[model samples]
Target chain A: MTAYTATVTVRLKRGVLDPEAETTQQALERLGFELSDLRSADRFEVDLDAADADEAADRADEMAERLLANPTIHDYEVAVAER
Target chain B: MTAYTATVTVRLKRGVLDPEAETTQQALERLGFELSDLRSADRFEVDLDAADADEAADRADEMAERLLANPTIHDYEVAVAER
Candidate 1:
């Protein structure tokens, strides 16, 4: 088995209300930083033993689908790299 | 000015207690997914008009330093892409 790190990024779907991002944008503006828009996401990195990159990605994808992301409101992407 | 998106990823510093990640790992184990370890992070995507990629990255880095991440406990990275 090879060690692989699966990176899963979960973000709210488009048109969803992102109060956190809004608050962040306001905070940046308050600090005199100019920005038109902002969005926020959660990223999870899982280190595990797998046969190959594809196997690692598959397991990570399942984890995202089952726990990391809310299917109705979140869109997630999974990437794997050898460790 | 050109449209750009700045992606800032914030993660806890090593040795910091990451309860969320620990809980997530436990949950995945309960779901029958095998993983040795897991780490969680926050990512922010800021869309704005900037003079260049470097300028966008600079602003995003400042945002991360001032608001998005806690310098005492978190580490962050900033990436910029044309939008």
Candidate 2:
């Protein structure tokens, strides 16, 4: 089996409130940096063994769907690479 | 000036503890998924006006350094793209 690293990025769906991003934007403004808006996401990198890249991606997708991401509020994408 | 979006990613420095990632990994294992290790990071996307991409990136870098990231335990990157 080949080893792979799967990267999953999870972001809040459009219209979802992102308080942390908002707070961060405000802090930037206070620091004299100008910005219109801000959004934040969570990125997960998982290392595992699999027969091929596709298998590794499938497993990582399952992980994101089941635990790493909250479906109702999150949108996630997965990318796999040999490790 | 033009509008730009800057992406900043914050990750725990090497040797720092990441309990949340550990918990997520355990939960995945409980669900019958195998993985060697898991790491997580936060990504921020900021939109702002600047004279050019360089200015936007600099402002975003400042944001990451001043508040978006904790230098002691976090490492961040800034990327800028026209919006």
Candidate 3:
């Protein structure tokens, strides 16, 4: 098995209420920064051994679907790389 | 000014304590999944207008440093693309 890093990014789906992002956007505006809109997401990087990158991504996808994200409100993506 | 989207990824600095990541890792273990290490980050996508992509990226970097990330414990990156 080869060492791999699986990255899972979880974000609230469109139309989902994201108070955190709203608060952040407000903070940026308070700081005199210019921007139109802001959204936030969570990223998880898992290190493990797998047969290959595809297998690693599969495992990571399973991980995200099961625990890393809330399907009703969130969308997630997975990427894999050598460790 | 042109429309642009900025992505900022905030992550805990190396050696920083990440209770959230630890908790997520534990949950994965409870589910009988195997892994070595787990790390978590936050990603922000901002949509706005800029003179160019470089200007957008620069503004996003400033956003990360000033409000999006805690410089003491977090590190952030910025990427910009035409919107």
Candidate 4:
């Protein structure tokens, strides 16, 4: 088994109500940063022992879709760190 | 300024009290996964117009330290996407 670290980010698609993201964007603007089209995302990190990178990525993606995120309204991506 | 995307991950150092991580670890174990030393991490995605990649990374690291995380018990790293 190979030890791998996975970082998963879940975000509401555009036109979703992201109060937290909106609040942060407002705060950033108040802090004098002109940013537009701001969106909020949540991240999860997991360490797993899988047979290979492909296995780890597949399992992480499945976990994201099944438990980590609500795919009907949210989108997710997994970034696996090199071992 | 250069438009770039930044992904920041904030994680508690080992031995910190991470109740959420513990809970998730337990859940994963119960789901037939034997895992140990589980730590939790948070991810943030930011879009910034910086002068360069280094500037963007620096600003992101600063933001993660100053606002996004409590550095006393947490460590953060930033990954910038190639534009």
| Index of the highest-lDDT prediction | 1
lDDT of 2 by residue, B1-83 (tens): 99898899899999999999999989899999999999999999898899989988888888888898999999988888998
In candidate 1, position A58 carries an lDDT of 93
For candidate 4, lDDT tens digit of each residue in A4-36?
887778888777798887787677677666554
Candidate 4: true contacts recovered, fraction: 0.35
Please identify which of the two predictions, 1 or 4, would achieve the higher TM-score against the true structure: 1
In order of DockQ, best first, we have: 1, 3, 2, 4
Candidate 3 docks at the CAPRI level of: high
lDDT of 1 by residue, A1-83 (tens): 99999999999999999998898899899999999999999999999999999999999999999999999999999999999
The TM-score between candidate 4 and the true structure equals: 0.80
Q: Model 4, which residues run further than 4 Å from truth?
A: A81-83
Instruction: Flag clash pairs in model 1.
Output: none
The TM-score-based order of candidates, best leading, equals 1, 3, 2, 4
Best by DockQ: 1
- B70: Cα error in model 2, Å: 1.0
Candidate with the larger lDDT of 2 and 3 = 3
Interface RMSD of 2: 0.9
- Write model 2 residue lDDT over A1-83, tens digit each, in one string: 99999999999999999898788778778887777888999999999999999999999998888988899999999999999
Candidates by lDDT, descending order: 1, 3, 2, 4
In order, candidate lDDTs are 0.94, 0.91, 0.92, 0.75
Higher-scoring candidate on TM-score, 1 or 2: 1
Two-chain DockQ for model 4: 0.47
Q: Which ten contiguous residues of candidate 2 chain A have the minimum total lDDT? A: A25-34
